[model samples]
Structures are given as structure tokens and as C-alpha cells.
Target: MEMHIRSLTKPDGRQLRLYSRHPIEHVENAPSPFPDPLHANPHMRWHPLRGEWITYAAYRQGRTFLPPPEYNPLAVTRTPDNPTELPPGDWDVAVFDNRFPSLSLEAHHPPETIVPTMPSTGKCEVVVFTQDPQSALGKLPLAHIELLLQVWAERTLQLGRHPDIQYVLPFENRGAEVGVTLHHPHGQIYAYPVVPPVPGRMMQIAAEHYSQHGRGPLEMLIEQELACDKRLIYRGEHAVAFVPVCARYPYEVWVAPIKAVPSFVELDEEQRADLARALKTVLMKYEALWNRPFPYLMAWYQAPTDEQWHPEAHLHAEFYPPYRTPDKLKYLAGTELAAGLFAMDVLPEDKALELQNVTVQLEEPAHA
Candidate 1:
């Protein structure tokens, strides 16, 4: 479970860290497409009606989007003259400070407005899943996938230690349908100064449920899903993946450890390994189900990183696929958008059957 890390400061003053199972040696300094220093000064405004904070970063409009097939910024730097975000090295994963982040640690000087305003004092980072831009997460080896879980655990522990950060969310948006301009297999980490609305309500409800019954809501749901076995996709020794009975999306699926592990930092070796298996199973099924690349928003939810124990929090991942069928997409409109209530056209059991029919063989790479 040992990981070697090499930290480097990019020419543009951004931070880059490379991780590997073996020693990360003989790697050149990190590179950046921009040469000038990035002076990010994002701010947050209070929404009186929603009772929440809204972050603003006008510069994010200029972020790299839909680049030509020849040029990928996430790719390893080929020549020193035209460098990319990463250095050519034998690293499994790479993480760097986002050039156009919605929130920044250096944010300051909020402008006067009618609503309350403050500096967006948080962090946004991009996690490059692999060196190859064409590869997908499910195509990775099990050992490599396990390494990603470890990387997430390390990031959560490090970012959570900051006093200004209250919550950390790791999520991925796949395909152009999900507004992913970059086709690279990667995800993002958002360390928030405050707990966001969705996870905030989730924690509140979980705490209430845990108080009434000595288990979290997800844990109780997991027990029921396991007992029912109708919507079950992959049920491992320590982890499980299933379609929830009350799914909001047409092809929605949930993955989690059998036992309630509050966060990635608390997952044992068994739980982490099994969790990777379950994740890969779902991703592979999604691809095979439609005979094409599936587009989905995958989000991992854990406890708030406010330096307090949260026994009610249960670590889990939810996958919201956009497609209702092979060709048609399920759009959120009317009641779904205005009322915050999701309308599903298909049943969860029916969608679960579609994924369960696809067979996937988890094989290790020859080198591994």
C-alpha cells in the first residue's frame, strides 16, 4: 500500500504532484501552457432565497475546452518548448491546481454588493486518472484502480486538515453530454469552505436516522437492497452496487461498502479493494449496455471534513447516467428542475435488469 509521490511547482506558479506505486524518479519539472502567474480572486455571494453561497469566477470562461485532437493539455509534456500539464514520467496518477478554478485559496477582496459577500477561500484541483488520454476508468487494471482509491484517501486527509475547508467532494463528468469538453479520463476535487446544499441535507437526514436507529439511512437501504436482490448489480464481500428502488434518474446506480465507512480515509484494505471492483463493474456494464461510451455524472459523498467525528456519514458513490435508452436522453425540465423533484420514465428494476445482463471479465494486465 506504499505510494511514492513527487511534488513540483509549475512554471506558471501552479502546484503539481505525481504519484506511483514505484519510485517516481528521473522526472523533469512540471510544465504549464501559460507562462504568467495566475492571480485568481474569486468571490462568494450569499443567496438570500436559497440561503446558500454562490461562487463566481469570470476567468473560468477561458478554460481549455474542446481542444483539437492533436493537442491535449492533460497529456504528458512531449517537448520543452510546448509543454503540457504533466511531465513525461512513469506515474500512475497526477494532480495539479486548476488554471481556472471556481474557488481558490488566494481569493480575496470581495466587491461590495447588495447581498453579503466573502472571499471564495477554498481549492479546486484536477485529477488525471492515467497517462493515456484515450483510456477510460473501467479499462484500468484492478490494482491501478485501487491506487486511485488510495490517492483519494490521501487527498481527503490532506485537504480536510485545512481550517478553512469544511467539505471535500470528488466527482467526474463523462462525455460531452455532461458538459465535459475534455475527453480525457479524469475527475475533480472541490474543497469547499462550507458544506454544500446537497450533502448538507444528506448529513442532516442521516444524523436524524442514526439517532432513531443505530445505523445510517444508506446502511439501512443497503441491507434492504441486499435482502431484495432484485436491483443488485454487483454484491462483493465488502461492497455492493445496486439500482435504488426510488431512483431519480433512469439508469441511476449506487455503489458503497457493505459496512458504513464514514469516509475514504476510514476504508480498510478489503473495503477499498471491493469498492474498486464494484465501481469497475458498474462502469463496464454502462459501456456494454448501449454498445457505446456511456455518459454519466459520478459523485462520491463522504463526511464533512470539519475536524469533527461524523458517525452518521456513510461513504458512497452515485452514478447518474443521462440516457433513458440507447439513443434518447432524459432531460430535466419543468417539475424536475423548478420543483427539485426528479421524474423518471423507467422503473429501477427494469434498468437494473439491463445492466445485469451485460457480462464483464475483470482481468489483470500482463505486467501486473
Candidate 2:
């Protein structure tokens, strides 16, 4: 597959990222003309959450890596305790409203009342962690990682309480491989007026699982995974982080509450700290294996708190790092793009053990 490099610039003069493309689909083993309704096209994107599908067959021409326009620069930065100066405290993890939000906090989302409408009405914020530009969570000390987890749990809890807000999505975009523009150690929160699709589908499946098996779907997965011990990444007291049984990526890791709380924000102080330890362990392992800046997207899924609709939503985090082979990335091509199915090269069991047994040295902190 051919590779190309591109860049997207922010108004602040900071280039958000350099786009290095890789052929997601390798047809060396497939038949000449792939025959299936799923592969009717070469590349397409189904915007499940937005209820739309976009074809990227012309991805090679000119629209490969055009970055979206900058939204609110003011919202991306921190709101200092004192408006006249920089933030006073040194924060390892912090939560703030996302500047480039796909959703908005609708003061009042009265039933459409228009011809065309999309649910861009929600809230999103960026969670900036250290002032340093190149700090990754794995590099942070265990104590700092603990504090960061605390911030995540707190934000989820506090944001979930809003009468207008339904779901709180806390996610982080790491490395250029995953389209993460900034090098700063930070994440984001999207407080939605409605539950997003992935979680929504999960809620549907979970409800069905509960009705049929008399237990949560994730509960079923945790049981099978723990006993199987194949995809288990890190098993801690309060939480269990592991790659999924049918992993979609090379080293995709998920963190779930073992106690089966409805949401992550519901986790107590101790549970939050345990989550921190488990997460740090996963990132550290990934770094050790890759040995460089291992990139991945870390996302938290919570039950959208509306007046009351979705009942079976269980909170969890998804890590979808595109890096399958070292320096190689998995792009969403024909299969994932056209069809909903996902294909991965690495075995989950092997990746799990590799991450579990691997270790790394923490970077020393700078003295103030």
C-alpha cells in the first residue's frame, strides 16, 4: 500500500497533525472481485451515531486528510482560578468542555421544528492534563495517574447530574497515527442530549442478554474472559482491563468495573484509584512492547441520563489504537468502511499476555 503525509493547521498556528496514510485493506489473499453485498463499494463510512453514511471511494484524490475547521479556541484551554494569570495548580488530569464539539448543549431542543435536523445538540470538552506538550499517561507516575482517574470519575459524576445532559463520554486521542493532533496528555468529555450509537446498540444487546440470560452482557463477557484468561490484560481488585474476546484492533484494551456499577462516575474513591492502577498498567505494557510513543484512543461509555429511557447501559472504556504492526496502522477501508465487520491481524490472547507480562521504566519528573 502506498503512503502519503499531510498536515492540518489550527488558527493558533499549531499544526494539529500530520496525516500518514496506510492501506487498511490488503487483497493479497482475496478473490479477484470480492463478492458480497457488504463490499459493494471500496470505502465508505457509516455515521452510526448521526444516522448517515459517507462514501470515501474518492479518498485518494484530494479529500484524504482535510482537517475540520477550528471551533472555540477559548474553550480548549483551561479556565484559570484567577482570570488574570495561568492556572495555579499542576494538574495531572483535568476535564474541560471540548472546543471542536460535534454536539452542543441545546438550551431547549424543542422537537426539530425545522425541515432538516441532526443531533449536534450536545456538549463536549477537552480534559487537559500536564502543561507539558509531550506527556503521555503511561509516562505519568502512578500517583498522578490515580489523580487523573479521579478527575475522570468526578467529571462523569458531576456532568451526569445535569438536567439537560444525558450521556457523558470521556475519551482521549493519543498519537498522530490515531489522528490525535496534540501531543499534550489530555482527554475529552461529550455530554450528550442522547445516547450515542455504539453505547445505544450495547444497551440494546445488554437488555436482550439480561432478559435472556438474567445478567448484563458485559457481566457475561467478564465472566467468560476471566475464566478463559486469554484476553485478560490486567485483573485488579476494583476493575478489570483486557482486550475483547474478538478484538477489532491489534491491541485494543477495555476497562470495565468488575462490581458491575451502572456507570464509571458511580465508582467510589477506592474504585477510581483501582481503575487508575489498571489503566496505567495497560498503557505501560503497550509502551514497553512498542517502546516508543504508542498511540491509542481511550474512550469511556456511560449510560445517558435522560428523564429515563435506556435501562441496560453499563459503563466501560474502549481503546482503539490503529497501530497493528509496529509503525503500521489499520485503516477503516472496504470491510470496516463498507460493512460493519472488523478485521484484525494480531491474536487477542497473545496481545493480552504480552501486555500482562511486559514492564517499563517510568520517566523521571522534572524538579520544580
TM-score top scorer: 1
| Model 2 C-alpha lDDT per residue in residues 1-368, reported as the tens digit of each score | 12222223333222121111232232111110111211111222346666742323221243233334442221223432212101223223334433334554532332243243343555556665554555677777766665565566666666677776667777888888777665667777777656666777777788898788777888778888888887787777777889898888878899877766677656676676667767777788888886788888888776667645444666678898877778577888989978889877778887777787786443432111
TM-score to native of every candidate shown = 0.97, 0.71
Quote the lDDT for 85 in model 1.
Answer: 88
Q: Please, what is the whole-model Cα lDDT of each candidate in the order they appear?
A: 0.91, 0.60
Model 1 gets an lDDT of 0.91
Clashing pairs in 2: 97-125, 98-124, 98-125, 98-126, 104-122, 166-305
The residue ranges of model 2 lying beyond 4 angstroms of the native Cα positions read 1-86, 90-92, 106-115, 307-311, 360-368
